[model samples]
Target: MASNAFRKELYVFERGPEGKPVMAVIRNYTERDFDGLIRIQQESFPPPFPSELWWTKEQLANHVHLFPEGALCVEIDGEPAASITGLVVDFDPSHAEHTWEEITDAGYIRNHKPDGNTLYIVDVSVRPMYRKLGLGKWLMQSMYEVVVQLKLERLLGGGRLPGYHEHADTMTAVQYAEAVLAGELRDPVMSFLLRCGRTPVKLVAGYLEDEDSLNYAMLMEWKNPFIR
Candidate 1:
């Protein structure tokens, strides 16, 4: 849960389809927000992914302890509707493609490097009811703010293709990613990342056990525009 002293909010107003302004409150995660975060994760990601993949209280605590400023949540009607979590890491091309466990060290976040050049995104989730409101992009924009504040060179993460299971028998993960990039196919997550100017760096096998992604994930990166 977040400490009352550290709780702060940023109001974001977006034009709805009818030209009405939709208001959302973006704020940092608090210790009290853990259950809501976990609930959102469960609702956002369905079966074939065990509960272990969800952010445990311990993991959340570790993240907050290591970098409290790296986690942010978007609240709607006083409930957490979306959230983003990340950690700073030194970039290493030689070890660019790492599994989720390898990158997060089993969700302990012991690898966070304050002086690192990369902001490695560990997780980003939005409630199912809030999908079409452009909240995901808002969460991402907030992440860019974190990158700038930390003076990082880039943002990196393994993007899951929740729709990949449907194409597993027909195409490889790499092929699917290329097709999505070429505008031939649409993916809930990958397409959004591409639209945000993130580039796919590589295909990582066994990134997670999610059957939807066929156990494969795309290594994606977005370079910091503010940094040369």
Candidate 2:
């Protein structure tokens, strides 16, 4: 069992296979969750994404050690189903061009800053089996709540443009993103993010190694208006 120090939570989700409502538990991940986290990462990002990009034991450990509050996990039926990892950083929107490694300290979150005003999301993945359960949205909401509770300015992430590759030949990454926002195009990542209340700030390149995204991503952010 994990410690109570972490923010343990229960979120009711859509009905399960039996047509009965199910409950998912959200909480901070610990050292023991490394294997499960690794499994999910592989399941989420397969061969083309580069196996080396997967989470390392050291990275997972550093996440919990440096900032337990930012390390989140989801459990359904006592099994790890999804996870989201992030760190706090002092973000400058005007000068926001950066690769994932620079922002997240190579996934170890060694760059986490407690006094920073932004919650920088580094990774979010859900098991294929539970994708239909709406766990992704719930996980994001959990992080948004963290931003509100910490009195942060906003929550942000370099969201991959997974559907960009399809339109890459005819349009630029920025144009593709704008089209998605305009409802003229539907991108898996961009559409899901928009539905989650995140607004795209700009299109960034070299954000990560997602071939489907053509190594480009849109910087998305959700401001915490209640933070004064």
Number of the predicted model whose TM-score against the real structure is largest: 2
Residue 204, candidate 2: Cα error in Å is 1.0
The TM-score that candidate 2 achieves is 0.92
lDDT of 1: 0.82
Instruction: Give the Cα error of residue 97 in candidate 2, in Å.
Output: 1.3
- What is the overall TM-score of model 1 with all chains considered together? 0.88
Report the lDDT tens digits of candidate 1 across residue range 35-129: 99999999987775677788899998887788887788888888899998888888786777678887877777889988888988888888888
- Off-target runs (Cα >4 Å) in candidate 2 are 1-11, 14-19
Model 1 stretches with alpha carbons more than 4 Å out: 1-16, 46-48
lDDT of 2 by residue, 70-186 (tens): 888998887789999889999998998999889999888888999999999988999998887788888898899889888999999988888899998999988898899899999
**Model 1: ten consecutive residues of lowest lDDT:** 1-10
Which RMSD values do the candidates have, in order?
2.9, 2.3
Q: Which residue pairs show backbone clashes in model 1?
A: 1-30, 1-31, 1-32, 2-30, 2-31
Model 2: pairs clashing at backbone N, Cα or C within 3 Å? none
